[model samples]
Target: MNAREVNTLNIVGGRVIDPTTDADGRLVDIHVVDGRIAVIVEAGGALPSADSVLDASNAVVSPGFVDLHTHLREPGREESETIETGSRAAALGGFTAVVAMPNTDPAQDSRAVVEFVREQGRRAGLCEVVPSGCITVGRAGEQLVPYAELMKSGVTLFTDDGNGVQDPLLMRRAFEYSSDLGVTMAQHCEVSRLTAGAVMHEGSCCSHLGLPGWPSIAEELMVHRDIELVRITGGRLHVLHVSTARSVEMIRAAKADGLSVTAEVTPHHFTLDDESLRSFDPVFKVNPPLRTMADIEALKAGLRDGTIDAIATDHAPHADHLKEQPLDTAPPGMLGLETAFALSVGELGMDLRSVLACLSWNPARIAGIADRHGRPVAVGEPANLAVLDPGVGWTVDRRRLASKSRNTPYEGRSVTGRVRHTVLNGRAVVIDQVAQR
Candidate 1:
């Protein structure tokens, strides 16, 4: 956080579940001073002076979340969302850091643009915004962006998110250089040729509705292709928004084969099915369209079995009128940053620790921010943390949301879990479920 002068902050009576320290459900008190963990005392045995104390009773205090995918829509599309508003939403959702996507007006291809986005996030003083660079210049698939140049700006993740790299040879060349550069090439996994004018998942739902279907094969093909490419090139490849059963199986096998590959699934894919499109609301529409129940089950199995590396929000915010358009013409996305954790906890049926693994440490490592973002709540560590009440229940209200756009699919639906507070770099950015700044 950009809060320069951090006061002594004490968070007491929370069940500390730090995977970094092998702590599971241990009740403790954490003292943050000078933007670092100063002391950690066992519950009921704390004698630490503090300027402010946050009662974290009945809550799980862990490292703050890091989103591998978040669309802040800055630099050009401020009508949809801004860096400040998006960071506010992230803080409320218990995220201390978020990887800002590169699909902007000028595209985050150069150091200047990515630096601008990072500066805007710092100006907001909410969450740490790490801007990802475009894999291709201008997010156009013709030429590769200067990875080495952009890396100087602290961009470790590169992806042409709105579309996949169409050329296999070009992708291979990118992989060859990525390993040497110590960076990751994340693919959108959709071959545009296959998804021309496509709407929802190509299934029975589309058959009855008489609308164009975005086939599952479109994503699976690219996932398989990238796995093979990684097998040959020996570079890190990350498949984004994985949605198909076959894709999950392929990634699991690739990992077994010792390929440097990682994949992430969105909350919408695992929580909602293609059947939700029955209402014909464009809000249900999203890229890598929602799949069948079988696919959802496979996604859950992957997460439980440690096949999926993370649960990224893919938090895209579109303007009001854009999502109000017809399903065929509307943009394929939904507001996700604020609701991803609860949706995952409610739908996955996994234990709280496993759920946190997907939401916190796992994604943090993937985004390459582990040095600061995803760390244990122990002494001498950065004080980035999320305090969660797993037993709490809440419903979404469009007006109450911190996001600038209102395209959330769960507008009135009840969801489990709530972020009680978010501490970013020794500052409590969110306290008792409210953004402090």
Candidate 2:
């Protein structure tokens, strides 16, 4: 496909909810030509004959979502996920782009690896896959990678996701070095010393189950340290997968103080609690383990009040048998890309616009991908949009997911809201809840 070519597509009779253009709740028809929004008229308005038409009555037409964090496990771990499968899952979740994490086998520290990942995403053609750089060499936590080099290679976000930068001094220097690079330092936010052998959140749940606890303090300590570091270094910091009450409060306070700090919370953190661990399902296991109901409420409040900027999926995928291992032995992650929209809508208790903002626009700005993604639904803009049914309810089936792995914790859970059609670059990658590819 050429850069300026797309099938003539028309999305008819849908409520357009674009916060950027003050078009929320307006019934509009979107026309796409050559991959750009050619016109938006009232529902049933006449227009040029389109080869493709999607009846979106009672649905929502909004900017396609952008996930700030996603593990596309390629270049080494294709057994878990590749850019193509992950992009398919993302498209089904209404995401037009996902920032690919740097925790792969070789770790995306070099420009060669970074370009390869970006090129693979291009080949997939499902969604935009933006590669992130490692904060440290090979994400080893001891030495810093070349930020200028990575930035020139088009990576604006950097992180050591599976492992937080354990050394405070090293983290401080990372922020300092980022001062001139115009990159954001994203932290996984676990103090390694505090979470050495932990499996679940520290609380009565762990005590009752006789399991090692991953305490909230381990996350809060790093949150506090990174905030102070940003305060001093005047560099931007993005806290990834924040899961604790105190961590939320500290991030709220840091933002109030006018620091350039942003944060994201995973759907699993807000939708499930540590009590799920009582069932001994390794699928519930995650790096930032699920916390108490109190923490879930706090996270919901954070999203409601804008303390947390984006609702990232953390979209970690593991092989079937890997997640089927005993809790203590299994890898800590769960499939998220396909279930995030349903979980967020049914659980957040917020209005449609705010919820979509957290899922789309907010994360787009954070990931620095607002130019091509998360833009308003209007004429002359790229037609990257998600047609959503906010009131539809469905149950998740792990076997039917587009992801290469089947480790979703939301399996069998009933949820509302679904991505009906996902139009990426003006072509329907997902139509009627199915990936066209």
Candidate 3:
């Protein structure tokens, strides 16, 4: 399918809530031409004609979401998800951009892999798919990837997502190297030694179920290590999938101490708990496995208080054969992109603007794509926006999701707030909840 070339579009009668520009849910009409915002008029002000009009009544129009962590699983694992399929899922979920993790079959540690990912995204043309480079060569954690070369190829964030850099000296060197290159390093924050046989959080649920437990310290220890490393090297660090109360406290302290650290919490981390593992279902399984209810409260507080910088989906998708295995044998992950907004709005108790801050602008800044995505809704900014109905409720049905995988943990759950339209570079990739291509 060819990319939809939208020349002009007008989003009408929506409550514009651009936190970047402080629009604050004001009723306005936004006009776009040639892939850029042409004008933003008040609700009753005169409007310009356009090739297409999206009626956004009773909706909150804001910058399209930017996910800091998304596993596209392409370059090898096409049966699970390809760049095209993942970008389509992102658009339908109101995302304008997603950072593709570098844990593919061959691993995205080289310029060829990085360029291949970017070119595929350009061909998809649904959303901006930024490729994250692997911190270690082939994600082996033994040696670092070619940072300067990858950075030259436009890769900004680096991570060995499935595995954290375990060697302190190696990680410090990575920090030093990345600092010089002016790029950011993201850590998955798990100490493999402590989680060798773990399947879920080490808590009452795991004890009762006789399942191997993944202790919070496994993640917190790494978080602490990375914080100190960032403090020592003054290199920017992003902690991924923060799942413990202590982890949040440590991040808060790190920020107070002026360390260049940013952290993200997954929707599942803030919404679900280890008790979900009691069902013995694999859908509840995820890396940095869901923690206790106390951890959930802490994550929520961190988000509300600004300690947690963004709400990334970590949208890991696995085929049925892999995801449907017995709890101890199944891979850890869950479908998130499609239900992220609803889960945040219905579960976090945060206002719509605050939610967008985490889902949109903050994440865009973290992923280094703020220039185009997460831009203010004003003249001259790129027309990447999402029209969301904050009051509407919908039940999550796995069969209806855009991703090829059906491993959503929120299946059958009902939640308020849904994306009504998503405009990507002036093109209506999604209108009235339907994907355009």
In order, the Cα lDDT scores of the candidates are 0.91, 0.92, 0.92
Give the candidates in order of lDDT, highest first. 2, 3, 1
- Write down the RMSD of candidate 2 (Cα, Å): 1.3
Model 1 Cα lDDT, one tens digit per residue, 13-63 = 999887754436799988889789999889878557888888899899988
Which pairs clash (backbone N, Cα, C closer than 3 Å) in model 2? none
**Tens digit per residue, CA lDDT, model 3, 32-135:** 99889999899767888999999988889999999999999999899999999899999999999999999997899999999999999989998999999999
> Which parts of model 2 have CA positions greater than 4 angstroms off?
1-6, 21-24
Superposition error at 89 for model 3 (Å): 1.0
TM-score of 2: 0.98
